[model samples]
Target: MPPPASSQSCAPAPAPAYRGRFAPSPTGDLHPGSLMAALGSWLLARGAGGEWLVRIEDLDPPREVPGAADRQLAALRAFGLHPDGPVVRQSERGDLYRRALDRLLADGHAFECHCSRADLAATGGIHRRCVATTRRPRPAVRLRVAPDARVAFEDLVRGPQVQDVGATVGDFVLLRADGYWAYQLAVVVDDAAQGITDVVRGADLLDSTGRQILLQRALGLPVTRHAHLPLVTGADGRKLSKSESARPVDPTDPLPALRRAWAALGQDPAALAGADRVTDLLPAARTAFRPQLIGRGDTAS
Candidate 1:
């Protein structure tokens, strides 16, 4: 995060009102890096005078931690980032994803795949030769990315972006072979249903925007504006993630962690010194929010 702007010229564009969301998977407690994402999305939405919603992306039950969703929400409240609408859980929205998948299958946009992770890893994750019909009753479903098909979209912070989905990610999975909806499909459907206008999250997910865009187009749904913030990294130079043993943010005393997240976005935390509580600091932070100060790949160390 950058220093608080001294003049109006350095402020972020209070644009075309937004409906942003902070969707997180409940695999563990709210870690520091995850707090940055939560704060970034919350600030962006509040700054634009728009709605900020919360969605618990618990699609993969195998990875979800029991009671983690409620704990995550509690952490956000400790830092004063509350949602404008009812919180949504992806596990309860299977029917919506199934309906969307049915449409894609009916239109010949989606196909079944029996390839496993190990199988795709060997082929560089392209899955180019998996076109053969499923040998088993249960098979994963994948969206057919046309050869050399260029998917382009403007990222608010990263600028104009382009990617050849077929060459990069190949036929991406929409439904896993294990009877769970893939992140790509569930997120697209939920975002559309929730009327999410902007998506502000960690830069680690920047690459995923392209695939999500492809899904948006295939579903005939409007694509939302995206602004991926710089990721927070551990001392080892890798992203701070749950799987990496990243420490969870302190829920009992969230102020310090909240301040660190504020600074991580390149914002000057000193301005918030007088804010005795987290909720009190948010209004001013929202006003001082400047996404442009966030440089690409400027990971929080």
Candidate 2:
């Protein structure tokens, strides 16, 4: 077996470099909505003269597509969104997450629970009751949340934000009974591992930011600044999802989708409409990119 990861390896990376990342799950192809997230994060990093990276969130094997990771990378390249460093995949970094979980358990910040979804739902959608119990075949690890753990942060685009994770989410899971690492734990660990200083993604995940911040504090990791851009919804007013049959961006002719994505972020596309390729369009977009330009509410463009 390989050597176990040390505490240093799991801790937040030292700062000074302005690092940002675009992490996407490989459950399906890169749709227009996904492209918007990719573009927003890319522009923010590149515009700040910082390094931009990509990490494939391929931890959930059951929902992952067979060849989606490669396809997603190819699409990003076709759209002229290249990373500054080598790509990282969550599936290959299990040891790091395991080490972090061990630390949390050893520090008495986390515990094992066997509560099922039905059980949590009956308890007002929280695992508070089962936090101290360790009964059952395959138990999940949950973090002990303090009732007054109210986290607040300034969002670059949306202004001030605050949420009481302990009151709302309550002793969230770190690892599932099925043995897959929960997103809250993996995301916090990876953001620190990648030295991410800014998190630019769609507003759909804004609610979960509080939980992430709480986890970061529990792990003594640095909390990254967040900028949640407007989400692109369908005709039904629902945010676009790959699982719901949202069409993926056309790899051969990504210009149209790119233009739409640019506009969806509240940037004017007329300035770059004459450009033929993503390479020709990014320079001007980077010059004008700012999260504040994106308006509030779901964008239908």
- The top-ranked prediction according to TM-score is 2
Q: Please give, for residues 14-63, the per-residue lDDT of candidate 2 as tens digits.
A: 65457888999998888888999999998888877898989999889999
Instruction: Output the TM-score of candidate 2.
Output: 0.93
Q: RMSD to native for every prediction?
A: 8.3, 2.6
Model 1 C-alpha lDDT per residue in residues 1-301, reported as the tens digit of each score: 2122221121122334688999999998899889999998888888787899899999988889999999999998888888987788887777678888888999998988887776667777787668343365798899988878788888877899898877888888999888988998888887887778899988878878888998888888888899988888887777888346478999888788988888898888777787777667787787777877776775644
lDDT of 1: 0.81
Local error of candidate 1 at 189, Å?
A: 0.3
Instruction: Give the Å error, residue 134, model 1.
Output: 7.1
Global lDDT of each model?
A: 0.81, 0.85
| Error in Å for residue 206 of model 1 | 1.3
Instruction: Supply the global lDDT for candidate 2.
Output: 0.85
> Model 1 segments beyond 4 Å from truth?
1-16, 117-122, 131-134, 243-245
